[model samples]
Target: MKAIVCTGYGPPEVLQMQDVEKPRPADNEVLVKVHATTVSMGDHRIRSFTVPSAVWLPARMALGLTRPRRNILGIELAGEVEAVGGQVQRFKKGDRVFAATLQGFGAYAQYRCISEDGPVAAKPRNLTYEEAAAVPIGARTALHYLRKANVQSGQDVLIYGASGSVGTYAVQMAKHFGANVTAVCSTANVELTQSLGADAVIDYTADDFTTRPDRYDVVFDTVGKASFGDCMKVLKSGGSYLNCTPVLPSIQVMRAKLSGAHKLILGEAPPETAEALDFIRELLEAGKIRVVVDRKYRFDEIVEAHRYVDQGRKKGNVVISIV
Candidate 1:
């Protein structure tokens, strides 16, 4: 199996392509022949060790003190099941599936084995492998925070950075959750966000989005460029402020929920974070959601994809086809 192995954590260049032994399914696992996967912001963050010092310390304990515990760096994948363990009941050898690989993180390889109980789901019939591969990570994150926000139909929800992988899904899912969506992004992504069912668009380059007179019932800051305090000013009295970034202040906001204003919300999506994957899969299968692929890269070009995503201007997801 050809896999992208991270020799050490520093730059995208550290991800070296090598032929590694293919994994076999365990008694309760399924072996998947990966057709497509994604090079997400999470992948970059892990590969480069770009997390906050507080978060990094814990992550280092989990990943490794010196190098990563897991060598291959990928999570989201869409592919066909090549074989299933004897105990597997929900899937068979030919079942098409899409899933997030949690800590098992080996989707950068040509094959991966995942437990049937993992975030695995039947791939939506309407989507291509590339499209399905892009869903799990970003969609799960969006779903996690929106549920935290408890979005209501008539209430206004503002999605800052409503153009990134998670932001695009956040916009659409919030609309699906019945909120009137307002997307804040650059002029280039205005149409893309609006097309995803955003009721209004704010060009951040031309306007201070916080100054808008219409306060929102929920404000989701997907980019983390805005502070919780800054976002709260644009929220209605009881509105919640949600951020995707894993910054220290966001962690404090999460802790503050124990004593202080639950109004400021911080979303910490857990690994294997499949709690929201089922909902996202249903929405996709029902045609209520769509995957937004800003670009597609081959396995060999993954480092380039990382570079593009690191530029901080991607309109949507960046896919990497594994097959």
Candidate 2:
């Protein structure tokens, strides 16, 4: 099997294409021949090891000390089951599936193994491999934070970075949660955000959302571009703020406990639980959520794909076609 091997924690150039042994399934695992996979902010963070010190330290202890523990770099994949262990019952050799690998991040290769009880799900009938590959991470992140926000029917919710991968899904999910959605993005993305069901679009280049008078029930800073204090200014009494990028100032952590008007919630990708995967699959089947892909790269050019995602301006997901 061919895979993009991450040489070490550094720039995108560190990713190299090489021939590696194909992975086989264990007694309780299913071996999938990957057709598509993704490159996202998390992949870049791991590649360059740019995560915050607090997260970096703990993650280093778990992943490795000086370099990465695993050489393959993808976390999500959509593929066909080529073989199944004798104990596997939910799927057969020909079933198509999409799944997230919580820590076994080997989807960059042509074949990878997923446990029968993992986040793996039957691929939505309407989506292609590339499209399905983009959903697991972005949709799971959006779903986790929006549920934390607990948006109400008539309340207003603001999403920062409303045009990025998670932001795009956040806008749609907020609308699905019945909140009147206001998306914050640059001038170039106004129309795109509106098309994704944002009730209003705030062009950050022209207006400051935090300085506005109208207060929101929830302010979701998908990019972590603003601090908790900056976002708190526009929150209504009892409103909550969510940050997808994980960083919390000590004062804000303390303040959240004391004030009803302000609160902070940090996000993580939902655990690869059965219920969470089922919920995402249900939303996809109902047509309430969709994948937003910005670019597709051939498996051999995965190094270039990493560079594109590292640019930090991808409109949505970056996919690598493995098959």
Candidate 3:
């Protein structure tokens, strides 16, 4: 099987294509022949080893000192099940599935062995492998944080970076949760955000969202570009602030927590689960949520794909087609 291996933590150039041993399933796993996968922020962060200097040592220790603990750097995939373990009854050899590998990180390969009970589920009938591959991580992250905040009907929700993967999902998910959604992004993404159901769109380049008089019940910084103080200023009392790319907690974040004036919800996304995948699958199947794919690349073009994602300009998901 062919796979893209991360030689070390540095730049996109470190990712190399090589022939590797194909993976087989365990008694509780399913072997999938990957048809598509994504170059996500997870791949970017791990390959580039970007983090705050404060947590640099700890992050290094957790990932790798000189290389990634998991060298193949893909977190999500969609494919056909080529084989299933003896104990697996929910899936068969021909079932179309999408899965989140997360920290296990082997989706860059032609084959992956995923736990039958993990974040793997039937692909939505309406989506292709390329579209389904982009769902697991982004959708789950958006759903988790929105639920954590217990976003309610009639509340105003603002999403920064609303054109990116997690941001796009957060925009749609907030709407599905009945909140009035406000999307913030570059001028290029205003229409895209509106198409996803954001009630209002703010172009960060043209104006700062913080200067607006209206306050929001929930403010989600999907790409970590929005300032904490600026977001805090616009957050209504008792609202929640969600950060998809969280850094060290600041004094204001702590103060808000101590005073019970606001809540800061940030960090790694919740571990993927079969239940979560099933829920997202239902939404996808029902057309309650939509997959936003910014671009697609051939499997052999993985390096080019990585370079594009590295630019931080991807509107939604960038998919790598494999077979």
Alpha-carbon error at 291 in model 3, in Å? 1.0
Q: All candidates' TM-scores?
A: 0.93, 0.94, 0.98
Choose 1 or 3, whichever is better by lDDT. 3
Evaluate model 3: give its lDDT: 0.91
For each candidate in the order shown, give its overall lDDT on alpha carbons.
Answer: 0.85, 0.86, 0.91
Instruction: Indicate the TM-score of model 3.
Output: 0.98
lDDT of 1 by residue, 199-234 (tens): 999999998886778888888989788766667677
When summed lDDT is taken over every stretch of 10 residues in candidate 3, the lowest stretch is 266-275
**Native-vs-model 1 lDDT?**
0.85
Error of 3 at 164 (Å): 0.4
Top candidate when judged by TM-score against the true structure: 3
Candidate 1's displacement at residue 65, Å, is 2.8
Clashes of each: 1, 0, 0
Better of 2 and 3 by TM-score: 3
Ranking by TM-score: 3, 2, 1
